[model samples]
Target: MEIFNHNANINFLGMRKFSVGIAILLMIASIALIAVKGLNYGLDFTGGVSLVVDFEQPVQIGEVRDALEKGGMEHAIVQSLGGTREVSIRLQPKDDPASGVANGGKVNLDRIAEDVTRTLQAARPDARLKSRDYVGSAVGEELRSDGIIAAIVVVLGIGLYLGIRFEWRFAVAAIATEAHDALVTVGIFALMQREFDLTVLASVLAVIGYSINDKVVVFDRVRELFRLARKAEPEEILNRSINNTLSRTIITALFTAITMAALYFFGGPVVHGFAITMLIGILIGTLSSIFVASPILLWLGVSKQDLMPKTKDNPELARRP
Candidate 1:
């Protein structure tokens, strides 16, 4: 079941410039929105209250959320726990404790909890509070810093690994591709004002790994073609490589999308952010491998010699001169 035929002759490289242009415009828009609107950091990065409650009966998650909004906790994260009557809610800190630090003063946690409980009781008369946890501003700051560090480390590790396995040009191209996927994903979150939490952060890391896998598939094909298409121009060789692997790329992305779509629909609200990030990343990463990464190779002037350095006085180089 190949999405593209074995004998396909799609000139993927020929469309690189147009694709890159579109990516550039997207990057610019994403950056601007990020600067202006910024991300909606969740309780994971901002001090907040985590509440678990048990209701006497199964209730609509939507009405519970609406009650929270009416109670002045706008955009609160609420989800049913394990298909049961239990629900967990994270109420964003009311006093700007985004730094996760107590800062010498605090809101009365008990009062806040009472107010939230009463609000939900209006929706479901039998709401019973099970437990409440207060995350300080300091904790949010640490989590936020750690999440940023993790993302940087993953990107650098990929660059180093690719550099050692392939060439620096390919490594750089891979890094650029990762950046393209990451930025677009982040931009979407900012533009939509979605909550950025631990789960969403994990999704970002997952997207980085997934994007690399797609790039490696194309890079592997390019290296194989370099040895056989020795007389072909870089663009022609790249076009051949991408066309050959196009089927595999599409199939992989298609199946992955199916899985994520199911999660988005059935996995409940708790995993919604995670599913959305992955869906966008997979699509961006697949296209970036062909348009963004391959075009970078062309700019770097990568040749057969770069792929196979063991052979001295390469025939391709000899023929070039």
Candidate 2:
């Protein structure tokens, strides 16, 4: 039934303040960068005409963009996905009201598609527009709302589950850790100008799930130590718990990171961003679960007595073993 074992727990309580300060500073930087540069949202959430084209041979993104431009779609976005042979084309409505806007002032999707396709075809005779779709601005707004709701629900669910499983304080610590990791990840994306799309959103969720799983493992040990070593100080118990789980955490995180790195390097365009983001998340999650979250619990005054059951001298549940 044992997943893994380790020799000692690392004492991070001594450095908790410094670690948290650095994380907060980085988060601030990330927010500033996002505000200044803005996010480069994808077509799915930005309302654009999407064209999927499969070429007879591998084609570069530059070539596709050039083709679309020559065909008269001068401001289209071209990206390759799945493989270099497959390309995704996106065209925003021209700002000029006379051409893109409707006769009645409604958004004109049909005309945009028609003009984009014509331009693409004219630029490359052999290039065929495999499929096309469009999302109105109203639809994009809906997607943004849904994505935010999903993230909030996930964090709240993790907090509730942890509170029930351990104690409210442990749950609080875990959620703070999750927030830390999320903010750090977003900051990196903002600073590096990484694409934040639906897939990236999925990756962020995955990171939260993975990071919390690690925290739960460590927290379980801390709770057990709390019950057994009733006289031990909170810092001692936390240090022991983290040290005991250190090896397992490192092994699992490094293993996951290695696999993610391999996917990033060799998995082609489809997985490059996802793998990179996951790799960063796992490493951050592991570090924060130990150095950041557990230590903060100490600062917040979490201790063995806080978790002890009290029902006017409560009875201890008998161990089945």
Candidate 3:
């Protein structure tokens, strides 16, 4: 089970300057990317018309997209739904000034559905509309706002928990690490112009949980080492703690990344956003735990006194370690 020596003496903290520099650069780049390019919000976020169509024969996704584009439905998002014969099409709401429809006018779901059906029928005569749904711009706006609120709540909740479990230093370090992992993961989607949907958001939340779990493991080790080492410096204790848990962290991330890779390859387009987000998250989260979290803790001046149990009434016990 041990992929590395339990007694391994890797000087992880020795490279703190370089690693922290890289982490800070990545975080800055991620922030810039998000602010500039922005995320490619999917159907769930942007008000859109979605149609599930079934053709008598299997159809290539590219051909369907081409047909839609040729039919004046440009910027359509198309994907296969389980099989080649069925596909889902999503399109942003359009305005019809000629028909007196304003830019943010109510979307006519039935009319949009009819247009999509007609367009597809021209390419595939037997194309039949199976289902149609519409997300209003107002609704999408609310969902978007709610998603942001949820993320903020989760981050705050995590900070609160960490603050109580350890101390302000550990809490701040964890919050910063989690935020880094999230921004980098989400910023990649924005940079690549990938679809950011509900599934992807959920994966980001999962990444927070995963990243915090790793930090907790290492922090626990640090605390234990701090209590056990009589006169060891904080840096030495941190280095030993990270080294002791290095094997576990790498092994866990490896297998989890493998699982996410399989999902990305075999789980189909339905879960592509989720799978890919987790994959990116796993890589970033693992690296941040090793390089980012502990260094921040050290910089915050975490010491044995912060972690040592209060024994004011028992001077002998307090001085034992």
Candidate 4:
């Protein structure tokens, strides 16, 4: 199962300065992109009208999307509900200015629904409105706030767990790595102006979890090697640990990326945001585990003593390798 030699020595930490510089630059760029371009919040966050339309016969999603676009609903989010005959359409509240705001700045949901139905009927004579719903701006705002809180909580929770499981150095490195992965993942979305919705938010959180898992594996190896190597320096121990686990990390990321690619191509637009986010996160996370986390741990002065067992009963802790 090993893709690399069992006793490989690649000197990964030799390029620590270069890798760390690249990581810092990328993270800075990600932040800049997010701050400037901002995310293209989807129907779930921007508050919009949801419509379910039924046609007399099976129709292509592209055809429905085109019809809506021609009717001035270019930003509509269209997807198949179940079969080809049933389609779901989501439009931001601002799509139709005539029906967007009522007397006192309230969304005119009824008018928007009627307008959508009329537009669809014009395109297909038998197109019928199956259901209509509205997501208010207030609700979307609340969801956005809640999603931010959830992400912060998850990151903090991970830092706490790692602090307890390993040490403060590992915790700090893990936190930085996770933050880098999340920002880069989200930044790509903002750069591409991809729809940021509930599903995508979920994917970002999933990426944090996945990225940390990879780092923890490496961190675990580092601690083991530190304790086992009799007089190894922190850099030497980290390099050995990463090289030892290189095969596993690459293999895992390869298969996971392949699965995500399949999901992206076949899982339809409903899961596009999730699939794409996972794909980006995987690439960034894999690289960061090798280049980012270990370097940060080294810079934080992680040493054998930090991992050495303090128990007097364990004489092995003082034994030579």
Specify the highest-TM-score model's number: 4
For model 3, what is the alpha-carbon lDDT of residue 226?
92
Q: List the residue pairs that clash in candidate 2.
A: 8-243, 8-244, 9-243, 9-244, 10-243, 71-119
For residues 1-321, write the lDDT of model 4, one tens digit per residue.
989986799999999899889888888998999899998898889887888999999988888888888888888888898798999999876633587564546678788888788888888888998888877778989999999899999999999999999999999999999988998898889889988999999999999999999999999999998888888788888898899999999999999999999999998777888999999999999999998899999999998888876766568765745
Pitting candidate 3 against candidate 4, the one with the higher TM-score is 4
**TM-scores, each model vs. reference:** 0.84, 0.78, 0.82, 0.87
Q: Model 3, residue 244: what's the lDDT?
A: 94
TM-score, ranked from best to worst: 4, 1, 3, 2
Stretches of candidate 1 off by over 4 Å are: 54-74, 79-87, 93-105, 121-127, 309-321
Top candidate by lDDT: 4
lDDT agreement with native, every candidate: 0.85, 0.78, 0.88, 0.89
- Model 2 Cα lDDT, one tens digit per residue, 158-239: 9999889888888888888888888778778877877677777789899999999999999888888898994979888888
User: After superposition on all CA atoms, how large is the RMSD of candidate 2?
Assistant: 4.9
Select the stronger candidate by lDDT from 2 and 4.
Answer: 4
User: lDDT score, residue 292, model 2?
Assistant: 87
1-321, model 3: which lDDT tens digit per residue? 888897788888889999989988888999899899998888788778888999999899888988999989877878899999999998886668532246756677887888889998998898999999876768877888888888878888998998998888998999899989998998899899998988899999999899999999999999999989899698889989998999999999999999999998987666888999999999999999999999999999999999987787688976887
Worst 10 residues of 4 by lDDT: 95-104
